[model samples]
Target: MAERKPIESWLTDMDGVLIHEGTPIPGADAFIKRLRESGKPFLVLTNNSIYTPRDLQARLSRMGLDVPVDNIWTSALATAKFLDDQRPGGTAYVIGEAGLTTALHDIGYVLTDHEPDYVVLGETRTYSFEAMTKAVRLINGGARFICTNPDETGPSTEGPLPATGAVAALITKATGKKPYFAGKPNPLMMRTGLNAIGAHSETSAMIGDRMDTDVLAGLEAGMQTFLVLTGLTTVEDTEQFPYRPTRTVDSIADLVDLV
Candidate 1:
């Protein structure tokens, strides 16, 4: 009935949409390549806060995708930005690996467990009960609570493992303070990604695999959303959600021609 708006830029979820279990999905690399060649601004959005952009780039390079480090946006980075904007040069008691720590450090945040301004939770391979206990006490003692993502579990070679959200829940139960999540499903993360790429929401498309995180975040950010049935979601799964994606495809392969 009307002319379709051209997508001038894009934001894509990394784990499910582009790769799965440490492997690139078929046609994902080509899709990224096409975006690169076309000079369209795009960003790879990830909720995984375990790795830095350089580490992610190396991993993607091994999978034959040549995404530059700057093209990758992570929840850790968004969390750091949020902290910096809220409290410049603030102190934090962080529970994560190099990715989260590095981002905070880059923004001039001091990491401390001694009466810190915030208790920032992030994804990690090892979830120590001792550290979690410390976090609970700190929040009880009046530190603000923040989290990188709300994913209750993360996929691994073995199986799904408890993630930041699960741990945050434990802390919340102990202290009765819910964390402010900084990852997908939060429109702030999507807006931060768009700001990083200098892209407009109206002409941008967000490609994701999950209806809850990717689609919701994209829609909240005022961008068109596309769901790819490559990982967690299926055609039937969409019905479970109250909202629907602007488009759905079997895989990224099906959308290559549109590039």
Candidate 2:
């Protein structure tokens, strides 16, 4: 086979690479502004499937950062896309909120309160036994399983909240079946985002705080990876990472030179 060409588009991580705890990393806005001014395209990709692009835009604007809705893509959106590709006419039993549902609908997947062709697991504040039972029944009936992410917990200013992976694990335990995940570390989420935006792997890159999720996904996607120290990954954790990033910076400001 011919050697693959380099990436010509940029794919960036959201939480730690650009913002943390709803706060913009120092110079993140300016870095994006520069990219915008330079006519460079970069998508703000997040593993959080709880919100739509509009939701993320609103939240970022609240932090005094402005981002177009189309420039943002969530792992939930990618998961929905992946499922749609797998089973176009199938109905999905979702364990997430409106964002995930919106993504599924946008991708032409039917949402069913009854027996579904697929079971989708994600982060939710209103998880119910009813939903869990539905998922279990679906799995037992040979329905496909897909999860939005695998992050065990999400870092918050207060601490960590049970992430999608935690809830996914619960269902996994009940069903004794491993669910397919579509977020960082899996690479498919980043690949979906790249394909959606028509970004090339050679020019694309993932910048984030977590080594396991953000960086690993980039590596798997054959894109450059940059690690920032604003979130979960600490200095010591870097030493333990099985894979290292192409670059490491203290903050987004430190990466102002890259974009």
Candidate 3:
């Protein structure tokens, strides 16, 4: 093993690392404050593409967590970036909310159902049978498939709800085409976030709760990865994975001093 570069920039998951169940986790405020005071570029990342960054910023503000809109990144943004790079000003038949649609429109993508260049799938509370049928038909008609993230389920007050991955699976069964996932565990999301902040992966760090997505993405992207126990993965749970994060802390509070 070699000596790693100092962590100069940070990327962290939003739900698990910063907050839980719509509430701000303890020490989350202090962590954000320190990052801002240090003048280091940082981004709060999330796979949820239901709400735009502005909506998320306002929600976080209510929780007393000061996160700027620009400092937040979402799977929606990543998917849009990927599409723009692949086919600039292209047309798509989208099945998602404002977060995903706004991103595509911002990149000059036209949303249509008639022989689009791609059938873009994303996170949405309501999955309409009609819309999905249209997407399947478009994909069958030769449109390339793209998805924001591969998360099979999303958290909710009641329980886990079927997310983009699950819905994408349904569409795949119907169309016989696998959509390209643009978010975490793919490393493209990490790279896009790093590029947005003008940060180098070698000198950056990623803080996330899940070993499957967060830690895996960071490790593959050549950044130091920290697993916080405040969310999904546990100490015992870490042992089950074939790979491990660079370090594991009790919570976000433990990372404040490093910032």
Candidate 4:
């Protein structure tokens, strides 16, 4: 086997690795501080498309994680980038919040419901049947379909909430069309993120909490993967997956030295 290159840059999931349920994880602040002090390129990644980078930065700041706006990346941004690359300045019928809409708008995509070029779906706290019905109808009218991520559920104080992927499934069942997912588990998300930071996969490492999305995406993108147990995945759960992360640690604190 070929030897691996030293990790120079970093990519990490936001929710599980840094903050959980609106609280900062122990050692997370120090980890971010170390990364900043090192001057190594790093990005905070999230599949949640409900908030823009600015909004997220504020939220994280409240939790004591001082991540800069430019260091954040989201599924909404990735989806927008994909659309911009495929069809510049295209029209779309969007079903999402400011994060998704703002991203598309920033890329010169007009949001409309009449004969749009694509039906874009993204995460939102309030998933209205009316908006979903419009999406299904527009897709039936020959509009292409695009989704930010494929996460079926999202975390909440009460419990799991239906997210973009669940709504996307409903629209797919109605129109018999599968929207292209542009988030983690699709190497596009990881590759685009790496490119955004001017980091190469060969010298970068990804820190995540889920084996399904984060680890898989990092591995596919040719980066070393670290599975932190501070979120969804348990140590026992790691055994169930066919592929393994490059390393597994207890939490973000464990990786502070690596930065």
Candidate 5:
């Protein structure tokens, strides 16, 4: 491979790349600090829409990572942006928590189940059957389907729990309509992040742990992709995918110098 341009901007997935189950990954803090000190633009990207940027910032602060609220981007924000651009001030029947709902409201979207333009799905701690039923009925009634991400399951100490994608499947089966996901694996999310930072793809890099979502999204978005092994994906897992990240490292610790 030819020598690459020096990285001027950075994007990274939050859960697996920076932290795991609420603990900071080794060198993750230093990596973030380096970005801040060097004045390089960066954003911590996450498919999770359960919390707002403030909530995520507080969580990270508790874990000793001082990521600013603006430096964090969630699927909820991306979905809201997508909706606002697609149809400004549109109405939706939202199946999500404060994060998703708040983002929509911020973008001047009204949340309602009555004759909504879209049925928005997002990550929540509890996915109530009644809510799912309502969502299915709404979609069947002519509301469009929109999901934050296509992750089938989310990680937890108890094990994997059904995520937005799993519930989306049920809604699809009942309503015969599929949702347009606005999270990783969809280059739209990556492009949105890049635009937010005013960064060029050629001089930017995306750091992620998953081959399916993070790496693929970055690659498709025209950004250099790096895979960190501290999370869900393994070195062997890369071979399963047709595309590959620009480089792989055992942990974020190994990539600190590159920053």
Candidate 6:
């Protein structure tokens, strides 16, 4: 135990951290309401950057959640921030969705045709052979590889789909280069959310359901972490990873007592 600090602000992971598949986990909605009632600030951070804040709001609303747009954060946004910081005037050749394109554009990066300076990889419901070939070609040339996250798969009602990590692997096989991931376990993602929300690192907590990316990222970012078992991570999985989280609970329902 790393002496869990007195918590204040909150940065929570979506998908598993806040809800499962699409429904609010057990008591997730009530947890958010409690936070609102207590006047505590929290942001819903997610590695799934296929959708923007607005898109997420609509989707979550369909699932009976009452989250607002401003309180959402995504790895797509973080990837954009990373590229903006590293290369100020590079054209981006992306293989993600509209939200990713929008994020990069918002960060002042130009979308290009060929031989772009950067290749930003994200989740795509429709990854075609042509898209893969283009990405491989760009990486084979001189473009830097940037990924939203390295998750090989994401959870779903049916199962997991090939996540950005699978795409990164293909590019690596083609170009023999690893992409810079901008999601959890990468301190940049935490910095992006915390900075955006103007939250102090010490007072903030990263609440998630996965151990590898979410909890590890929180520890690396110097934030208290809470891991819920409702997602991909398991207690047995923790036995393998050496980095322990601040605490583990069944679901967001337990947050009522801790936070």
Candidate 1 off by > 4 Å: 1-4
lDDT of each: 0.93, 0.82, 0.95, 0.94, 0.94, 0.85
Better of 2 and 4 by lDDT: 4
lDDT of 1 by residue, 1-20 (tens): 35548999989999888999
Candidate 6 accuracy as TM-score = 0.95
All models, RMSD in angstroms: 1.1, 2.5, 0.8, 0.7, 0.9, 1.5
1-259 per-residue lDDT for model 2 (tens digits)? 3554444566777787788787788888887887677676778988888888899999998987777898898888888778878888679888897789898888888888576888888777777888888788888888878898898888777888888888788888988999999877887888778887777777787788888888888898888888888877887888996678887888888866666
- Of 4 and 5, the candidate ahead on lDDT is 4
Which tens-of-lDDT digit does each residue in 96-118 have in candidate 5?
99999999999999899899999
Reference-based TM-score, model 2 = 0.93
- Tell me model 6's lDDT, rounded to 2 decimals: 0.85
Ranking by TM-score: 4, 3, 5, 1, 6, 2
Q: What tens digits encode model 4's per-residue C-alpha lDDT throughout 1-259?
A: 6899989999999998999999999999999999999999999999999899999999999988889999999999999999999999999999889999999999999999999999999999888889988898899999999999999999999999988889989999999999999999899999999999999999999999999999999999999999999999999999999999999999999998887
156-220 in candidate 3: lDDT tens per residue?
98988999999999999998999899999889999999999999999999999999999999999
Q: How close is every model to the real structure, measured as TM-score?
A: 0.98, 0.93, 0.98, 0.99, 0.98, 0.95
lDDT of 6 by residue, 189-216 (tens): 9988888878878899988888888899
Which stretches of model 3 miss by more than 4 angstroms?
none
lDDT at residue 212 of model 6 (Cα atoms): 87
Candidate 1: what lDDT? Answer: 0.93
Where in model 6 is the C-alpha error above 4 Å? Answer: 1-4
Candidate 3 lDDT trough over 10 residues, lowest sum = 153-162
Q: Which pairs of residues have clashing backbones in candidate 4?
A: none
